[model samples]
Target: MFIGVGVTIAAFYYYNNPVEGESCHIQKENNVAAFVMYGSYFYLFLQFFLARYFKVRVNADSDKKKKVA
Candidate 1:
C-alpha cells in the first residue's frame, strides 16, 4: 500500500514537471491519481472496518459474576 501511494505521488510530481514542449497530460494524470488515492484510502478503511465489525471473542466476558475463579 505504501509503495503504491509512493509511486502515485512520484507520478504526479513527474507529470507536473514534464519536459518543456512535451504534453504533460495534467488532466488525465490528475484524474487517475485522484481515483487511485481515493481507492487506496477506501480500501484500507474497509479492511479496518471489517476487522472490527467481525471481531471474535477469544476470552470469556469480563463480568464480575461470570468469573470462573
Candidate 2:
C-alpha cells in the first residue's frame, strides 16, 4: 500500500516537472515529501523500540520476583 502511494506520487511529480535541457532537479515540495515519508518510518521504528523495551523490563521484574520467592 505504501509502495503504491509512493510510486503514484513520484509518477505525478515527474509528469508535471519534465526535464527540459539542463536542469533535472526535483521540486522543493518533492524533497519535503521525502522527508515526511522518512519521518513516518522513523516514528514506526520508535514505537517498536518502546514496546520491546517495556516488555523486557516487565519480564526481568517477574524473573527477579520468582528468584526471591
Candidate 3:
C-alpha cells in the first residue's frame, strides 16, 4: 500500500513538472489522469487487504468449528 502510494505520487509529480513547457501553459489540465491513476492503485491495495483479511477470518472460523466438533 505504501509503495503503491509512493509510486503514484512520484508519477504525478513527474507528470506535473514539464521540462519544456511555458510557465503559463498546462499539459495535463484535466487532472483526471492523476485521479484515475491514484484511485486505481488505492482500489487495488484495498482489495488486496480485504481479500487477505477475509481469507484469514474464514480459515480461523473453520479451525474453530473443527475444534468444537
Query: Against the true structure, what is each candidate's TM-score?
Result: 0.46, 0.42, 0.39
Highest-scoring model, TM-score:
1
Q: Candidate 2 lDDT (Cα, whole model)?
A: 0.69
2 versus 3: better lDDT goes to: 2
Tally clashing residue pairs in candidate 3: 0
lDDT of 2 by residue, 1-69 (tens): 367457646755775677676554556676567657766886898899899775645457779999999
Tell me, what's the RMSD of every candidate?
A: 5.9, 6.2, 5.6
| Model 3 Cα lDDT, one tens digit per residue, 1-69 | 477567556655766774676442434643456567768888998899899876645457779899999
lDDT of 1 by residue, 1-69 (tens): 667667666667767688878876557657596767768897988899888888785655666547865
Go through the candidates in order and give each one's C-alpha lDDT.
0.72, 0.69, 0.66
Provide the lDDT at 34 for model 1. Answer: 73
Candidate 1's clash total is: 0
Top lDDT prediction, candidate number: 1
Q: Residue 38 deviation, candidate 3, in Å?
A: 0.4
